[model samples]
Target: MEANELLRKVRKIDIKTRGLSQNIFAGEYHTAFKGRGMTFSEVREYQYGDDVRDIDWNVTARHNHPYVKVYEEERELTVMLLVDVSRSRLFGAVGEEKREMIAEIAATLAYSAITNNDKIGVIFFSDKIEKFIPPKKGKKHILLIIRELLDFTPENQGTDISVALRYFTDALKKRCTTFLISDFIDTHDFTRQLQIACNRHDVIAIQVYDKRDTSLPDVGLMRMTDLETGASRWINTSSKRTRQAYSKWWYERQQSMSDTFSKCRVDHASIATDEDFAHSLMALFKNRGVR
Candidate 1:
């Protein structure tokens, strides 16, 4: 894309996603991901109803009066967005492309992290690491991330989720809340890596898809191509049996993906280009709250 066109696209995404982060996702984002732990804030005079266990003996002795220790949740945290920028993300039959949706979702998450006074970072990857924006706080940092997400093209066309997850685990030593955003069409056993990552950091999976990806309508003969492999084939979409079998296979793929995520105890949610992503996100947040 040209420089001006790229800027325009980035600005457009920023406007839409920033509004969502500010108005809709801010509260739920904060509630869904908790802070590291409580930290001592201050000490105050013990009230009659104050818990005796909370009294600070040293402070009490110094002041010759009982003082209760006060602590607050350490709200500062690091949030990482591991985004897949593979060729398949460019395929979309309705609404925006999968890559576009991923950009918006990532921007919203970044803004939400900044809103909560947390540091936000991102790793854009395909078969290999494409770019890494170190965790930082501020609107500038978030906008920089948004711009990169909108414009950063991947060097590879294939997806290797295990490589990305392994890189993330090695780079970020501290515990963080990591959002893995992708279509998850690649092959590799990430269950072990994901389980380990979850043990060290909170992991959430946001899987993006298109309705057409799950089924084909009776639109007669159609040409289909694999974006990642560049393989082309003609399919008789008009045949009912063909469409039914294709739909069944698609459903099985989705079920297998869901089952894999479940086995790893990872919180996963799906968003289709044809559906309202806001509703899906809200539902996921509400579900997380229940947990």
Candidate 2:
């Protein structure tokens, strides 16, 4: 991508996602992903409903009146975006490519973090860690992330969620909220690693996919290739049995992924490229806030 073109794309994302963060997500995000703990804000005179445990005895004795300690939620947090840059992201099929949707969604979350005064970081991975951006708070840093999301190309073309999670656990010592954004297409079972990571950090999984990933139109014989494995094969799509088999395989895959997520106790949402991702995201955030 050219320098000017990249800037333009970044600007476009900035405009769209910034508005969403400001108008729709900031409060929900803050409520959903809380800070580490509460911090002492100030002391105030005890009210009728004040908790006796929070009463400042020393201050009370000094003033000869009951006073209580007041604390505010710690507002700062470090957020990590665990993004998959595998080759399958290039497929748009019926709508926006998974890669493009990932960029937009990631950018929205980054901006939402900014609104909440949290530091944002990103880890791009395929078969291995492609790049890591340290957590930092600033519009410039966020714009840089958006630029990378829009333009960065990976050296490998595979998916390994476990490898990325392992690397994240070792790299970041503090327990922070991490978003795993991917298609969930890896053949390897990473349930063990996911469980470990979720135990350490607040992990949320967002699965982006294309409609064609689950079903195909009976448009006659067609040839297709696996994006990650580069294996090619011809399929008789016109045959009803072939279509049924493919659909059944897709359903099985979804069920397996759901089971892994359940075992890890991680919150997750799935959205197709053609669907409205904002609604799904907001629903997830609202669910978390209520929890």
Candidate 3:
């Protein structure tokens, strides 16, 4: 994309995502992800309903009055966005591309993190780590991330989610909330890596897909390309047997992925290219908040 066009696109995404973070996700985001712990703030006069254990006896003795130590939640966290930028993200049939939806979701999450006074970072990965924007605070940092998300391209075309999960687990020693955004179309088994990552840090999966990915339209023979592998083939979409087999394969794949996530104890949500993502996101947040 041209420089001017890229800037306009980034600004457009920023406006929409920022508004969502501020209006819809502010409270739920706060509730879903909590701070590290409470830190001592100051000592104040003891109240009748105050916890007796919190009483500052030393201060009370010195001041000749009852006082209590006050503490506030340490509301500083580092959030990471593990984004998949493989060539497959460019494939979409129902108006919106998976890449576009991924970018928008990432931007929304970044904005939500910043709103909570937290540092936000991103790891863009294809078969390898394409880029890593270190965790930082401020609107400027977020805008820079948005620009990169809009314009950045990957060197590889294949998908290997294990590589990204391994990198994320090794790089960030401190515990953080991570969002793994992808279509979950991997040939490799990432169950072990995902389990390890989730054991160490809080990881949530946001799967973005398209309607065409699950089934084929009954329009006779159609040519299709594997975006990640660059392989091409023609299939008879009008054949009931062919369509049924394809749908069965897709369903089994989804079930297996769901099983992996369940075994890892990870929260996840799936969004389609033509669906309203806001409701799904809100539902995810509400579920987490309740827990």
TM-score of each: 0.96, 0.98, 0.98
lDDT of 3 at 75: 88
**N/CA/C clash count, model 1:** 0
lDDT of 2 at 286: 97
Candidate 1 per-residue lDDT over residues 116-164, each given as its tens digit: 8999999988989998889999988988998888888888898998888
Candidate order by lDDT, decreasing, is 3, 2, 1
- How many clashing residue pairs appear in each of the predictions shown? 0, 0, 0
Better of 1 and 3 by TM-score: 3
Residues 48-138, candidate 3: write the lDDT tens digits.
9999999999999999999999999998999999999999999888959999899999999999999999999999999999999999999
lDDT tens readout by residue for model 2, 50-142: 899999999999999999999999989999999999999999898999998999999999999989999999999998999999999999999
User: Stretches of candidate 1 above 4 Å error?
Assistant: none
Q: Which residue pairs come into collision in candidate 3? A: none
